[model samples]
Target: MNNLLIGLVRALRHHHWLRLLGGAFMLSSVGNGLTQVVVFGQLLRWHASPSALTLAYVLATLPGFFGSFFGEKGCRRVPPLRLLILTELLGMFALILPLLGMFYHNIPAMLAVQSVAAFLAGMSYPALTLTFKQGLSAEELPAATCMETLIFSAQVLLGTGLGVLLFEVFSPLTLLSIDAVSFVAAILLLAATARHIHLRPLQEMDTPPQVAVIRWAGLSILQKRSLLLLPALAAVGSPAMALLPAIAQQIRPGDATGLALPLLFARSLGQLCGPLLLNGERLRHYAKSNRHLLMCLGIFLAAYGALPLLAAEKTTALGLIFVAHLASNVVFALGTFSVLAYFPAQSVSGASAKAWRWQTLTAALATTLAAGLAAQWGATQSLYAVSLTSLAAVALILVRYRQ
Candidate 1:
């Protein structure tokens, strides 16, 4: 553990650009979390129903599809430092506009406001994605990926609690203003540190556009398996925490909200431990074995689905499932490391972007489908459906691995 911590510090100090980008990423992630709390709290203040919250989420995320496409376009043209600075500026503008709207008491159209951020983000998504993938040299991939996961675990475990506190202590208006300032800080940091980010000249860049497309269309057999097959299978295997409320309700009945936090906190602890375990020289080997890693995820998710029957009570079920959920995160982290370590750079056009996005969409669909199924087939039956989905993903992995 001490060695890992020391390695992370060494990497950060050794690469000034990594330090800048990592700082920006952490700040941006926290700022975004705090902003989300304020937005959700404001909706509650307006007495918006559950459906309204769902609509807001859908609105915010829908733009990502387009953003990833358009964002990469400009990123491909500009120098790395310029591209980094511009993306920060675009995000700053997007965030600040809604904040300004709130200050003037002219509440922007949620859809349009949300879509704008998504659109701007989509344009810069590739560059941002590359920040970790290619930002650090190949020698740093293991440490960088490990450190990034730790940061993510910290954000998830503590950020939610902090966001809640901030929401209570200050008004949404205040929160929005703080978020806008964070964006400005990120933009300024990139502008100042622009010189350190190195974009290696690629001979691949000079290839004719059509030839590039044809080449991407013709990826290696391994690349296709990692980018396409793995995600498609993981989609159904990815469990949705959105269903936690329903599960919590069954246990605590009316205190579902109260129980939700502890369960999620438990899950974050799992996320933290995942990176800790998948370390050492073995990290590279683990990151290469997508099939087995995903199979592990499927198994854990299947166990999670069976929690209702295994425990004979809500609290017991919750405890067992929390452990299962943690296992799922571990599996997810491993599979993800595999993708980043192996995904072909030429495949980034959009094929590889589907990785995280597809998992998210699949989880959302699973939640909605689970709810409807539960209403008709009963909770047990609904859980069985989830189990079946996960098992099916496992089957896919097994078949692919053998081939």
Candidate 2:
């Protein structure tokens, strides 16, 4: 643990660009955490139906498909740093739509606002990945990725804990306003970082327009198989995660709002612990066997799903949730590390964008289906079904892996 902490400090000290990007990521992720809590809290307060919640999540995420396509194309033309800054600026303005939605108690308006925000965030992803790939050395990539995940995890812990504490005192509009300010802060930080660094434009990197598509097509069968699993994982994971607030309400009907903070804190705490536990050599070893990571994720999620069925106590449930998220972050971090290591630096952005596009679409569809299931079978039952589905997906993938 001490060694890991020392390494983290050294990595940040050595990479100026990484430090800046980490700062920007921290601000953005904390805002995201706050937005998630506020939006879900507002919906629950409105007594939103399962279908309404489903639609909101789908609408917010579906546009990312188009955004990823455009983002990949845009980055090939514009310098990634410039594109990143522009997206952040646009994101700052987009927060207003949600503020308006909150003011009017209009669900549709909030949905639209979330869609716009998701689109801009999707568009920024490729640019952000490219920026990192361009700035860091091959040897530095894993440490940087791990550090990024750690920062995100830590910020989530801070943000959601803070959000829950503040929700009682602040209105939705005020919470969202705080998110907008975060975007502005991130934008300023990126701009300052840009002045100090020299990023070669895509054209200068000699990447042809068709290279991304061709590169993906040319990946090894194992690589392709591993990447394809992402969507299935999303289908399994996203819905349960999206319905967390609802699940909290189910777990504590008398004090759903009160219980939510503890649950969120548990999940966030797990996220923070995951990377810390898998740092350095362990992360690399796991990245080499993506199938095993998927298997572990499926198993842990299944256990988490069964907790409610066992009539578990609140403390037990929280402990399981923490364990579940810890496993999730480990899998996610390893998967991301594998992708980054497999692709050449120049192709990383396009490849990641393409992957994200499909993953987002799958998550939207799965969330919608899960919502319908939850409406019929209850949230806990629906979560169990999805967890089983994920395990089944893993089984199928493992069968193929043996071939």
Candidate 3:
């Protein structure tokens, strides 16, 4: 434990600014976590039409669909540190706008602002991803990714907890205020660390034809075969996330907060353990590493497939759901690490961002479709649909692993 802590400290010391920037980036997520859960729960309580909630998801997730195009440019023109700082500032304003709406009794207006803020925040992820990518040595990539994952996990757990606690004591707006302060703190930390970092700009290369960063050209991103799996995976897995609120709903009225909080905590726990389980050394030494990844995917699929059954049979299965969700996220994170390892250094940031963009696009598209279906068929049915899709994906992964 002492040695592990020491290593983490050394890792952070290598690039103090990255540590600061990462912390800032993560802190902002706390606000986002609080804001999203509260809004989603309230929308459900209001009996908001599925279309309304779906529209919100679409608006927020839509920005990420084109993030790859912007990410490429952002990677080329902007330093990662500067990019991270700028996005956090944008996120700060976005968080504040909604707080104002909540105070003024403008729920729709708040949703609108929240949607746009989510879009910008989603777009910002790639730039931040690149920044973290650049901070690690080649040998440290897996551990670095694990550390990154752990940071995000920590954010989700703490953010969800804090958000729930504040919501109980105060209101969603109060949570939003606290979230906004976190963004400010993140920006300050990044600014303080800016002087210590020197990031390399992208090397000059032949430019691809200019494409709209925000414009969705029909089938433009879809043409990339490798990128296709990204969206497929996201689409198949995301509906289970919809189960989060339902699980919370089952616990108590307005108790969705408590249930969802633990899921996030469980996910973070898995993230923390996953790195320890699959360090760079293990990843490098494992024979048939692709098969290993496949095994993890299988674990995720099996766990996810059992969730509905568990929820139906066991009234107090939150603990089971937590373990299952944690397993799923760990597998997902491992898949992400594999994808990152496949990228060339020069392409890492651009590729990482674009991949995530594709994932979000597919997931959003899936959610929009599922939201409509859930309105009619029920959320439980929609979950089964997602599980079937994930099982098929797992099969494909296994087959491909064999090849």
Candidate 4:
């Protein structure tokens, strides 16, 4: 706990602009959390099919996968900060699509809005990454990442809980309106952040395009191999999460709406605690020897998948979900830190963009597959299948490390 607090304090104190960035994310995420709950709750109430639920997850990520390509170009041509602000502004308007959808009770229209929101989010990712890379030193990166994870977890925790409460009283339209307002607040915060940081376009940096490509090309074979594992690593546990609503429904039949709050709470609490337990130093160490990290990830993921098979009780499932998310967050922290730490400052944006493409694409695919399995078989079986596939992918990566 002390370590977590110290790390967060140090990171915030070191970069004053980070507080602005963090604030922007916090407001945006809270709204996002509320919006998610409202959407899922409505779907549940309408008795949405497994395919429809899975389609929502797929749309949320698939556009982002394509947007990363454009983001890489934007990062090089325009200043990252400027690009980030623009995306936020556009996202604010995109919220209208969903609001309109909700008014008519059109699920497809509501789902379509996710694609727009996700694309804008994807477009901003490389810029967001570059903002940190430009602002903080290597020594500070781990702490910043930890702080980021904590903020995300807190938002999920607060957002989901608040969403549940608000859903009981407000209409879906009202909940979505709150989310739109959040985007406005986030844009204002980003504008403040812009005033504090002065960054050149990536193309204007010391490394020219040719030189950047050459530098990337010169990376060691092991480093290149490590990069390939990112998609698989990211896809880990995503299937289970994508199927979470379905899982809740299966576990407690008629009480999915009531049960979702605690399940989300447990997952968020686990994410909140994860960084505190692992800390930046441990994450850095794990990054250096990712084989052990992947091994641990496979174990936790398998256990998370297998638990549902053994027990039918909601309490036991919640405990397992918490434990699984805690470990998953650590793995995510390690993966993110490794990518940032591995690349040269000049190449980080491009590499991060490429990584986002594969990660989001694979995650979308995994969710789709899991959803199909759930539709055909069961949510539990789908989760187990994804977990076994993840373990096999891990085993392949481990074997490559040996060679």
Candidate 5:
């Protein structure tokens, strides 16, 4: 932990813009955990119908469908620093409206405000992703990426703990009011520091006739690879999550959630620890070791297939699930890092944005497929089928890992 703090301090000291950007996001992430639970709790308090809640969620995510295109355009047209500051300002307004709506007990108004904020938040992810890729020197990037994954996990952990504290100790309204203040503070900090970040990189798609054409044509070969390959492999891992409640059924019968939450907590631990495996040395080792990484990723997916057989000892099954999640995260992180590292500096942001779009699309498709398979085969056999998909992914990777 000391090392992580020291490493982040070094990264910030070396790169001036990163400190402000990272600080702003750290505040946002911290605030989001509390805000999410509070808003959800408030909607339940208002006796929001299931359909109304679902529509709110659907509306919130609508921006993500077009987020990459807008983010890439913003990168092309506006300086990333200015774009980031603008997004922060928009986010502050989004938060303030919701806070006010809570006082009026207006569920619809809160949902509207949240949807607008979600759209900006969605776009900001790619913006920051590009900023990190562009701003950090090559030497700083490896350490920074590892540190980034760890810090993000820590943010989730710490923020969740604080949210639980607030849920127990304070009113939901109080929690949201604090969330609004955090956003305001983030905006002020961004406004103060972001102006000094002057970047004038040549915009790759500036000559394009339309936004869609520009986004499509600007994708690099690596971006194409990430879009085509990674998401399918990710989907191949979906059965593990899909069958969790089912697995809980096998172990605890009627108390499915009783065991399911522990399984999730175990997986979360894997997420927390996974990125640590990709140190600077390991990354350098695998820079040309794409084939090796592909194999390991295949192996993790294959293990998920074996998950069904482990049900005799549910405790042991949880342990394997933990390892599988860890391996998946490590391989995925390294594969993505390779994509970011290998691409041209000018095109890295576009590639990263495209990857986000691919994941978003593939995740929806994969979830749909996983649900269909689960419905057909039940829990145990469905995982066997899921494992077969991983095997298929492995077959595909073996052919293309050369790239």
Candidate 6:
């Protein structure tokens, strides 16, 4: 524990601004959690339809569709830190709109405002994703991935803890105010550090045209079939995430909001521990020598696929299954992060940030489909569907691995 703490302090000092950027990312996540706990929970008091919640998710995420396509190119032109600060500013309105809607008792107006905020956020993701990826050098990649893992874990655990505590004492508007302040502070931090670091730009590559870039990405996916297969499978497994809220809704009517923070906390715990276990020199050497990252992925997916079956029992079984499910989820998070970090730096392109666009596009489609499927079959059926999807993806990966 002392060693880990010392490593973390050293990491922050070594990459101070990037570390700040990671903190900024966590702050943004906290703002997201605030909205989830306060605004979304408040909105649920009105018995908002699952469709409405799903629509909100879509609206917030829609920017990724276009951003994935164009964001990489834009990042090439702009400084990453500047782009991140601009993104933080856009998120500020998302914090404010809910407060205004609450004062007016205007549900539709609030949703509309939130939707716009979500879109702006979506637009920002590609740029921010690239900037975060570029923040680390090749040697620091593992620790970088670990730090990222830590930040997200902290965001989930601390954000939820903070949201629950603050919401208990204050109004939703008050929480929104806090969120807005965080974004402003994040922006201020970036602005202060903006000019200090000289970042490498994609133009330094004298890269091929856009069309050729797409072809190259496509070929990379085809050639590195094991690498591509895991993310693709992971994408299809997204329905498992959607099922959480739906199941929580069933656990106690309208308690879906209550489930978000706790589930996020559990996920965070796993993510934080995962990097610690995976980031050692031995594993890195093993991953590089054998280059069989897919084997670990297969084991993880098998456990993920089994979670639903384990959860299907009644009473005593349900509790056991739930524990199993949560444990599997943590392992999944660790496995996925580890696999993603193994991709060669040379595969990264100016138009995309180290597989970010591809992963986002794949996840977007999977989420859309999973949301629809969940709506139709309810949460349990969706889990079964996810389990089956994972099996199929796992099968494909195994075949590709053999080749």
Looking at candidate 4, the ten consecutive residues that score lowest on lDDT are 205-214
Q: Best candidate per lDDT, number?
A: 4
TM-score of 5: 0.71
lDDT of 1 by residue, 1-403 (tens): 4333455677888888777766775666566556655554454445443334344544554466566555455545665466656766776666665566455644344335556755554455455555555555555566665666665565445544556666567876676667677778877777756667765444332334222131335655554454543344435443334344345545555454455445545556666665565554565555456555665666566665665556455466656655665665555555445555554343343443454445445544554566566567654566567757756765665456432
Model 6: lDDT to the true structure: 0.53
Clashing residue pairs found in predicted model 3: none
**Span of 10 residues, lowest total lDDT, candidate 3:** 214-223
- Worst window of 10 by summed lDDT in candidate 6: 345-354
Extract clashing residue pairs from model 5.
Answer: none
RMSD of each: 5.0, 3.0, 5.1, 2.8, 5.9, 5.1
Tens-digit lDDT track for model 2 on 153-251? 754587788798898898877788788888888888888788766665445554453255525557776556445545655666777776666677676
> What overall lDDT, based on C-alpha atoms, would model 2 receive against the true structure?
0.71
Model 4 alpha-carbon drift over 4 Å, by segment: 1-5, 151-155, 198-217, 306-313, 401-403
Of candidates 4 and 1, the better by TM-score: 4
- 2 against 4, candidate with superior TM-score: 4
Candidate 1 — which pairs collide?
67-122, 68-122, 70-123, 71-122, 71-123, 71-124
Task: Please tell me which model should have the higher lDDT, number 3 or number 6.
Answer: 3
Question: How many collisions per candidate?
Answer: 6, 0, 0, 0, 0, 0
TM-score of each: 0.74, 0.89, 0.80, 0.90, 0.71, 0.75
lDDT, candidate 4, equals 0.73
Error of 4 at 98 (Å): 2.1
- lDDT (Cα, tens digit) per residue for candidate 5, span 236-332: 5555554554555555564443354445445545655776655554564554455655665666665555665665565776687677767766655
| Candidate 3 local lDDT, 1-403, one digit each (tens) | 3222344556777767668766776777677767765666566656555456555556656666674556557767877667767777777777665666556755686577656665665566666666655555555556555666666565556676566566667777677777888888888888876777665443422144333232324323222323344565566666665444553454334544455555555555554555454445554333234455445555555665565556443333545555554555555555455445544446656656666777777777677766777777766676677656665774575455332
Q: Which pairs of residues have clashing backbones in candidate 6?
A: none
Per-residue lDDT, model 4, residue 223, is 51
> lDDT values of the candidates?
0.55, 0.71, 0.59, 0.73, 0.59, 0.53
